[model samples]
Target chain A: MTSTSTAAVHALAALPQPYLLFLGDTTEAGFAKTAIGLHDWAPEVCVAEWSLPGCPISTGLPTMTPAQARAAGARAMVIGVANGGGVISATWLPALVEALEQGLDLVSGMHQQLGDIPELAAAAERSGRQLINVRVPPRGIPVGNGRKRSGKRVLTVGTDCALGKKYTALALARGLRGIGVDADFRASGQTGILIAGSGIPMDAVVADFSAGAAELLSPDAAEDHWDVIEGQGSLFHPAYAGVSLGLLHGSQPDVFVVCHQPGRQHVLGYPDYPLPSIEDVIDLTVRLGRRTNPAIRCVGVSLNTHGMTEQDAQAACAEISARLGLPTADPMRQDGRFNRLLEACIA
Target chain B: MTSTSTAAVHALAALPQPYLLFLGDTTEAGFAKTAIGLHDWAPEVCVAEWSLPGCPISTGLPTMTPAQARAAGARAMVIGVANGGGVISATWLPALVEALEQGLDLVSGMHQQLGDIPELAAAAERSGRQLINVRVPPRGIPVGNGRKRSGKRVLTVGTDCALGKKYTALALARGLRGIGVDADFRASGQTGILIAGSGIPMDAVVADFSAGAAELLSPDAAEDHWDVIEGQGSLFHPAYAGVSLGLLHGSQPDVFVVCHQPGRQHVLGYPDYPLPSIEDVIDLTVRLGRRTNPAIRCVGVSLNTHGMTEQDAQAACAEISARLGLPTADPMRQDGRFNRLLEACIA
Candidate 1:
């Protein structure tokens, strides 16, 4: 996702909760992931959901209008839809302006700044509300220097985008903490930022400073602490490998987990190329990851078998583990199936 | 180099030529590559050079002030110094504002926008002159798709930054044209953009669009035509590797030339990380490059031996060529030494 914000994420982190989620008029469940993620992960901060007519998807939160949300104590309205191109839709502007008019701050993670639109800017000014763009990175990010930092890191890498990298990282970080390990799940995408309340949107950063931003995201900590970084695009992805490589170099993860989806045939949008083999991903990750951290290795494989039956998922995980000689599990599997992956990471 | 521009490169390509070169007060020859490059490669468009007093370097062009250069038929003043941080120095503001007041359009390739400075903006407006920041990328860049374009491409990959990747690409493209071949030099950095007239500042593009920009830089062409692409950053670089990898995948070169400086032991600005062996670069580049172009190969090696004597340089090239069993030459050497490397590329 493209994000461009000059606003500090500290302000974003404290966005007056609970929020009114705005789902733009997109029927694609993929585009409404923000609302679903917030509802699933940060329910405490979500008051209700709002969408234009015929959007056909919901976060299952109570439906409300801007005025009703204001009365319901939502201090802010979060744009809960990620446009395919990271743009603010002209059709959705009327609803956004109403949210600002109703005494609520407007928050977005799109690359386009909200203040650039005259109507939104005027309404925000008239209502004395803030327009927060969390995607814009703060200035003065240094170029990455390749200096090693203290603390261990575990980055979740994938063969493609939206293939369980973020979910695996979140599960790993939470599981690490559950096992008495000091850990933090570092977010790198817009939806992850909204859920965690702070993150550097890696894809939106200037090309020159992406690695630097990754370094800033997970700074120095205790030697035993772990920063489980939410990965962006895969190392093999044609469009986003730059962000992926920069983050890999800067995070300097001592170990990483390879996250993949079974039964996928090609990169998300590019049909000319087929998906790379899991072995190829592992080989490239290790060779390239060695640049920043020589000890880097793949600790496990996290499969996203959302489409498969329980029996098929178990068989796939076992086959992959035996083939790669690494721990394997579906972190999102309903029956606490992340135990082996978590153990491999800490081991 | 970092550049952000909303203006189209078509406008930048037609920047009023017959220019005055502005050499900011820097004793470092490296930072003055912009002036040196334009003076050497595009001298017909250069009228004179200007530098703050006490600066130790010169492009050997006659010295002149903004007014004097304007009187000499210079239509624009090019900021000929590249700041290491891609920032505009406050100390250089007076000279820049004076250029605008003197009726010469001011042009810069710095990441900081020229119109963002109040004094420069006011002076340009009052004088009816334009302030051009070529570093800024125009909006609407798409994500890379890794589709094969109908052209043969030769990209100059480097072992480290500032190791003659641009020079090698420029020389190779020129040589190809000399032999009755259809070839175009594609620039991906500020200096190269200034020289080539129209090209993307790859380092300045948003991380998400950089690969897409690269794909745009070398689009479909005649089957036998060659696009000699100037690369940015090294795969070993901590900060800019993302830009490098994206460009590599997008360029999808059929053959690549590895450029290196003979004695450099570490990355230019990063002192802690040792440079990877040339063999390692080839191995990783081919392994990763095959994802986009399965036929990719390292054609030759280009060394920057400006610091060495002719005899020493020849010895170094010969030694490396013998060691790797690949053709090696100093493309910038006297007496047409790039012949072997050039032959390798097209053969």
Candidate 2:
């Protein structure tokens, strides 16, 4: 009774590929942060999306059945929504169970551990499936002492929580590597942890030990290698500023990139709290960073212009660049403007 | 085979109190911050000290034995030193074992979990003695949202790390109660946790949740009760400033008392990092706190004039008070000058 169209099955045959069926159905499909991240990063590994039965509209990816997903060599069914409080919806349980029955692995970056759910865990266990929960921090992370080390440490800080700090850091790291630079990406959050293979989920760490996690991640790189540390939270976020400051102090970055989503008028969680101006965030970052490292500087801006026209993105980037007297770019846009940021970071 | 001094036993009997064998032999005696804290707060609970075998020149308390300590009604063996990185020394194992065997409870505010030690834990288990690890955080602490709460929260911040913020807050609380005001002391560190019997070891908490622990500890206090929130590390401590900021943000106090130890030459752990001026610390606290609550204010000064001449203490307090236009007092000196500070806080 499940829909596995022949056209969808044939589409799987053209490439020797194993992809992910990002389950962003109903509420998750319309506005999911994790799904949006996967949309950008998953194409390299995934070929299709899988929505709930009643919700067919995905974020423009071709929808697929578990059989077609298997035909296309699907490896895992990713719970791709940035679910509020990270609790998995009861609505999605049927699809998740079905996917496990189809011998697919389960992966989630939710705050609520998928491994902790008895049904999904038992299903994964019985079917010999791997349920990789990415939000759990690895143990024995040493407390950060904020000791300054050699080589430039570049961190991407944001104006608000979930404003694409990880995306900016990764993209900047990739862009740097493309230009024959030895820049290593240091992941500091869940999604970044999943993509990068190694990172500390900053939010998951205890407060006093939070900085230590940052210190461990950016251990002494080679003199030529720049460790691009992914930032967490924001200095202005009422709920998360402590973690934000902890990461800022822990990394002891010499240069920082202020990442901002162009259209965010209010803080994501607290509507009453207004987002600080880009200038305010940049000034705050420099002032706080300089408290430990006097030489620290804000070198560029990583503007997340998602869902914007190319002309709008260009104008926003240019306007910010002009106002701040710093290079600004949407790293994912690949409009060649990101080169300016790369040059600024190195310079 | 162990030595128990008769004279020490007589001294303890006269006091009719609990004595602590401050294990400050070896490295702990020279510069143990916790021992220093206990020295200031110990007269409230303890009357004697017990040093290691070779550590004869103790911190001025009459040395006693397990038999002598028991005769004197010693209830617990307090680990007096702030051991480097909060590690319990191997040298103290025999002493701890001896104390445990003598039907005494083991008390430590160390970062190292005493419950994790197989030998010590097993010894405690066999003896049915309690091992009070003061630094263990209560589970399931939520992230602090920095939501404004009712009640007058007065936090005692410091110009540098370990400058007697706890002593100041406790003294202020006492002074407040002495005047018939309803005041509660909220301890935020290990030593304070021991003294107050309730608090979060703020430094041990994971970075993101650090603020949450602070939030939980100083919840909506009674309208008539002034929650005297004890502050932690200094804003200038290079290694611990993130925690300092976290505690600051988490408390979101309406008013703060700035604590300073006269003539502290350098930042505690870092000789290269000079301590910021009292004005600088006050300004920093206001700036940081104002980011969350615009009405936050620096109300007074808690100057620690320990080891100072009475005349010098008065002069120092007067000079700081005059220059800053704020009431400043050496809370421990009990010079009754704290009345001015009390007036400022309540005002």
Candidate 3:
């Protein structure tokens, strides 16, 4: 097996058995996508499925009950539900509680949990179910492979449906490769607060990849599977962006950068649109860091211009760095100073 | 007027007209309270009610047609719904669109956009009604106040809610007061993104506040009302923090500080909690600002601890600042260096 594969296997092998479960419902496509991603990272992990009972005509799929899920010997469970309000009802809570009471793990394929289901959060806390939240992009976005080998160490990038998080992840990974760091992008399910890559089953390969990140960035910790990078374009999506800071906290990244586009969705009523200048971002970062965790040593800033010209993108980056009083370098063309700074801190 | 009344008037007079709205179901307490606040703020601003014909409730209230609201010169409108979910029926959208189409202003008591009513965000955008998003905190908290004033300057503090925004806001406000800054706490509604001021009509206040903020802070152009300092919270809540930011972007401020806290709600299914550090918040702030406007200059950092002693708080603050590379100072005590910094930036 490749080193990445071996590492993922090792991480999965080290994990306690029966600690994870996978829950499936009508929106199996979305669920399967995320499950597949999780499975890819940790192949040896066993997942239990409990389909929702009384399949509504809308979805027309059988669902498993809490008892069935329990019978599957799942200590942890991942649930994927169909979209639409009717499907998320009080009945689901009981099943969820059952799993949690039995000390089973819990993860969700719910897109953006904050306003979507307040009860779910309350229930999880009450039942002590370890819930991992996943937000599938608006649909039809490919997953990104974070493989980098070059210039500035593009350490982190996030993706969600249309937010171009995957693209950014890919770009960052590729950019890092161009700069000489072996970087790879991995999706941590939902990329916001309340839920992130925390609960889904990570295969051995994925677990090892997570371990590598933990070791390289935060070696003192046993393993860091919760550090979810901020997804792109989320800064502007209503109810999704501001609270993302909460998710970032859940993920525990050394440095977090929010990628944004200005004037693209200006009329959408998204709060973070007309993206703040780089300086503003840096200033806010420092302030937020001071309040959250002071131990964070370094923060790096990058820009995604949403298909803007290279000059425009560069100008934006330069202007942002100048405003924030931080070092700035081009990701495409290697900047040794910037890379060295990032490598020294993150590595 | 009583001191409370007088304060209310001063606050109201400080706001602009033709930019306010009321929201909530007619029977809901929020509707009545908001109406009372509006009456206190701008007695002359006409209140037009729109109700579905089939809805038999609240028959005595003054109801208006879409055209009547337009003709009555209603620049803002408020809707009272039963709960956060009531805003999403087909009946509500037409009237809302009518108001927006006819250029009526908007506000709501529910703490989240009526458009968030089910699939309304997508529908509204598709229908050409530019929906400004806002988020209110969840059910457990009260409103928030503005910064504390010490002589002529102000001090502000922030925190991630799970790590402690409420406590931080309260503590920082108290800290500012201790230092002789007449400080007060402000709630960023439910989502902790926007400041939830009591007894203030948002629409009426938005224009004046935005203008004032612009004149005081940027002055070059109109600021994003959703991005103002006090308007920093979640966008999903009905009272979006972005609206506050937008309104206050260029308005008054001698200093700005964002509080950061550790610990977060665990993601479902993750084996461990990904608690974000102060550094993560700092990085987030920087990125958030960059994604919007980068003009905000952070001058202070407050470390929020859950009921820690003064000594512990100070130690936490010191450690956090040293690690984040930001200067640290106690807002409770006056210092020439800090004073100099504030004076130079605000001036």
Candidate 4:
């Protein structure tokens, strides 16, 4: 089952009393739709649209005076500020803080982009509110019909900032969807998915690292602290090239396709900073499959057209595959070699 | 002479009409001292103490209403807001705008690091006030008069988020000051600095890259545009790495010492992802130096402790130096190897 389907099933079984409040402006139509769609399973779900006097959609709700909004009782609040630069005004902070004090299960400060409003975020944190970020997908990605299904397992990639990562992720998602897979993309980071759902708490680990955990721990201590690993470095850092290997360990996968863009090609190594080749990818896959369940299958690679042309991207994929001895294909092409590789892996 | 001294001398020689305003909870004594310092140079230099309401210091000067503060001004205005989560309020935006509309020469938004207040900054920008950030150094950097430098060198790192960059720049300035270089960091983009005292009308370059610039340029052209470059990546992404490199290049520093905690080592390769090693650093330095100016001199490196022990730090420094064929010395030690390397470079 797809993650979204699984989530829906779980929601139906539990009958969650999901209460979402749309604070500030009304730019987050996608989130509203998502919440409203779940209303059938969560009959008790309440979505209050709160706004100031001049705000467009000020009806069917109490005036967005902080006190009135606090009294409305929302388990989760998604605050979407108007586009441009109004989100960071001092006038918007008090109301935000008041909502946090009233107690909220989850509070997402939904701005088109967070880099534009650091003060608002800092204020939300000071008020003891965990801010969740919901980002729009990139322009190139075809927004799939929400009601359609393709019976293929989906993989999602998320990052903290919305604009750039969203573009790459949406493109990747669309590519996957084009190949008969249903991919659900979301923003993930301190102010997004990690903050919203029940995942490994990276913040606590970060706090432990900041509080001198490295020095205090004995050499023989079990590596229960995931923060140390994250802090030491990730696949993105040469200091932690081994991190990707570590993260992939003990995982069962039929096929592994790494997605990246030319601008960010260095992450997986390219040109001068080359790591193992396509052969390494196949070798790792086979080794991992044997180590885990022996049912593990194939390896494929996809390149993001972040700032590269189709020709350059295809060339890069070929080079990567040739070096590693793994199967290679163009992700953007519907019936391209990439889809063939994926089919081979799953078959 | 120090950069600030050079700047002060240049300012005095040019005799620009200095309209200065001090914000924050600064004491009457502190205000008096600052006022006296500037009074010696320009008789028209105005000092408004926003810390106290109705203080004679702010009496007749055009008072900025909250609404005006939020509007964008053509000229720059300095501000000092109370740190510690102090709200500047949306109401204050108009007054800032009014100040800009009044044909002020410059606006410096000074504030204590009370806490994170992004709204105040947005209001200042909306008013078109040039927001220059100022802050006290961090704890590890020795403050007060034991050091020769009174304030740090104000190097404007990035302009997208002045307050955030200010926080990091201030920390960096303090780190530099601790090592006896009187650094006063400023948070202005290259455009801001070019127009700071130039009196030239600013024209923002917003090219249609894919249409206009992309056809004639290389693949990196899309990544070079500030908007696209800024939008695409995280502080840890490779695209951002170019931005940081650009910032470093614009600063034209004698030496660039990147300060990073061991935990956040991901930032070392940051903006490009997969942090480059000592050899990569050497290569990058050579590439940047050759591209910018053949006469540019290369200097040794320094590492911020970030709470790492002296032994571990020494080992890391040594490893880095051995890889780069550069000498490694203790940054903290009075007679350390790094100190000697810095001394030679400065000489």
Which candidate leads in lDDT? Answer: 1
Residues B256-324, model 1: lDDT tens digits: 999999999998978888998899889878977887899999998999998899899999988999999
What TM-score does chain B get in every candidate? 0.89, 0.81, 0.35, 0.39
Q: Give TM per candidate.
A: 0.91, 0.77, 0.33, 0.33
Better of 3 and 4 by DockQ: 3
lDDT of prediction 3: 0.38
Q: In candidate 3 chain A, where is summed lDDT lowest over 10 consecutive residues?
A: A200-209
Best-to-worst ranking by DockQ: 1, 2, 3, 4
> Candidate 3 on A14-123: residue-level lDDT in tens?
22333243333454455344344334333344444454564322221223445554565555665544455424445567666666676665544453342245665566
| Model 1 per-residue lDDT tens digits across residues A246-278 | 999999999999988988899988887789888
TM of chain B vs. native, candidate 1? 0.89
Sort every candidate by lDDT, greatest first.
1, 2, 3, 4
Model 3 CA deviation exceeding 4 Å by range:
A1-48, A53-73, A82-264, A267-272, A275-347, B1-347
CA deviation > 4 Å runs, candidate 1 = A1-6, A10-16, A24-31, A50-58, A63-75, A82-103, B1-6, B10-14, B24-31, B50-58, B62-74, B82-103, B126-128
Better of 1 and 2 by lDDT: 1
Number of the candidate with higher lDDT, 3 or 4? 3
Report the C-alpha lDDT of model 4 over A60-99, residue by residue, as the tens digit: 4334444454456555454533445324345655555555
**Number of the top candidate by TM-score?**
1
Candidate 2: tens digits of C-alpha lDDT, residues B1-347: 01111112211012122547465565544545555566666566665677677764456667787657877778877777764577888878888888778887777777776767777887887887767676666666777776777777889888787778888898888888888889988888777766665677788777778767778778786787888988987776666777788788878888999999889988776676777888888888888888667889998888989899999999999999899999989888786678989888888
Q: Model 2, which residues run further than 4 Å from truth?
A: A1-39, A42-140, A222-224, A310-315, B1-107, B118-131
